[model samples]
Target: MPASAPLPKSARRPRPATDYDVVIIGAGSAGLSAALVLGRCLRRVLVCDGGAPRNEPSPAVWGFFTRDGVQPSELLRLGLEQLAAYPSVEVCSLRATEITASDQCFTIVADTEASRTRSITARKVLLATGVEDELPPLDGMREFWGHGVLHCPYCHGWEVRDRALAVYGRGKGVTGLALLVSRWSKNVVVCTDGPGGLTNKARQRLQKQGIAVREEPIERLEGTEKQGLQHVLFKNGDKLVREALFVHPHQHQHTNLAEQLGCRLNSKGAVWTDKKQQTSVPGLYAAGDTTAGMQQAILAAAEGSLAAIMINEKITKEECV
Candidate 1:
């Protein structure tokens, strides 16, 4: 019989299952930073992101070294472009569905439109999945978030400097926020939103700083779509006009991915990680708002770099073993 051409395999080794030395979840500041480090080390790294960043609402992300006033989307785009230069790094524009540990490695399941579901095996996992902001139930509050009704003074304070500002504080942190906002605005009001836990000392401190302390419960927010916040409506049918409103949203972790992987969490429900960004679960690390309450992009990036170094070291040790 004539020799026939060799037959190609029906399924090619499935692209080696896209295995990696490190798998990072969430491609925000933290995950991208980690990818940059691991990729430089020539380690196979995959970053899975859902493309929904926590700071998407904010127009600009400040406090970064040189990219100050850069929009959040633009910053992420630049970061992704930088990471693309590394041949060892791959960015998957998808959401991580499930993660499980088995036989000294982590199995990550990601969902992609064309691929349906793809699995990756990794020696280490970094969780930079950030958090979600739970704004109070006030009318017009959500509509104007990031525009005029805002959070994080350092992030948005400079834009609204010297404007009439009001802070809605129903908790202990209100006093501190009021003081912080006062630095940017000469006219600041601390609205206690119905007096839940304001101490006499706290009230006096606010007054001493020329901050008006309002004990009325806010009913709703009044504003125009074009101009953002205009006034704070009270339960007693009173309205206090203001140019901007500062609020402290109840922040919550975006996913239970960390806790599900047996990582320890603090009393405040934040992921617990050491200075090296290693979590309670060995071979697993967490950074950014999910791990720390600081909630700043710069802090998240720093933590991610730390985690990357620690993870790389652990991987090296394992390879030697």
Candidate 2:
């Protein structure tokens, strides 16, 4: 072993780093909420939002105390407006496309726009990029997604209460949803759109509960501006008139950054995190719909706040900056 030699002329030096205490991807409810807490703690934070939230189609977001009935857009506008007071937090209308984590800091590459880019480095990273609904490939389904065709009964049930409603799915999923929805509307029907796929016992239970099961293949959904769902037309030429339709849509992660970073996925196919919201990778965390918890704006915000607190405490233990 001899003394270290000088670097070769062709060797590339490390790139300049634009640093922050935390870089949050997805400025939706969860990311913004975490940014609020982290900013209040005086942590330098950057939030990159691609825009078009998972709930963008929803008319109003409910279940949040003191803020029910607020339009989803208005709710986020208010969040960004209030976050402006915190000088430590900077929100950007950019999409984070890539993430690289090392023992010290995580490097992020984000697309500001077409062919434009930005590089960011942070001591910690929070992924709040939620899931996207995989709506049924039926005509008119996408058009009425948020209002006419709904997901959570608790979210939209009251508005459509006592009206004719339909649940779109198969097997136990539709049955369970139909039963839950029956509480909202006595005229609840489960539309399997093909085969009902119910056990005899399940069918008996549904029959006992006064819920109808329709197994005909769906032709298409006909809708009108007055109501999101006008009717469910069947291939057999019979149609069921319904006021609204509910579904437990299949969902996928909005961003692949977690998988790119090798974060373990939970049984629900969401990012796996410890009770502290920390992911498998150290100094990296996740919250909101991205986690295993059921998706909700208020819940995501709370999870974001909790993740920020944990991040701040970890930083304090490591000698806060």
lDDT by residue (1-321, candidate 1, tens digit) is 235754355532322233788999999999999999999999999999877799898888998999998999999999999998899999988788888886578888888968699888988899999988889888878988888888988888998899999998765788899999999998999887787487888878888889998888888889898788899899999999898999988787788788678778888889998888888888789988889668889889988888898999988885654
lDDT by residue (tens digit), candidate 2, 81-155:
999999999998888889998767899999986769988899999999999989999988998899889999888
Tell me how far the alpha carbon of residue 71 in candidate 2 is from the true structure, in angstroms, after superposition: 0.6
Root-mean-square deviation of candidate 2 = 5.3
Query: Which candidate comes out best when scored by TM-score?
Result: 2
Question: Which regions of candidate 1 deviate over 4 angstroms?
Answer: 1-18
Candidate 1 whole-model C-alpha lDDT, 0 to 1: 0.86
Candidate 2 backbone overlaps, count = 0
| Model 1 poorest 10 in a row by lDDT | 9-18
Clashes of 1: 0
After TM-score superposition, the amount by which residue 115's alpha carbon in candidate 1 deviates from its true location, in angstroms, is 7.9
List the lowest-lDDT window of 10 residues for candidate 2: 9-18
- List candidate 2 stretches off by more than 4 Å: 1-18
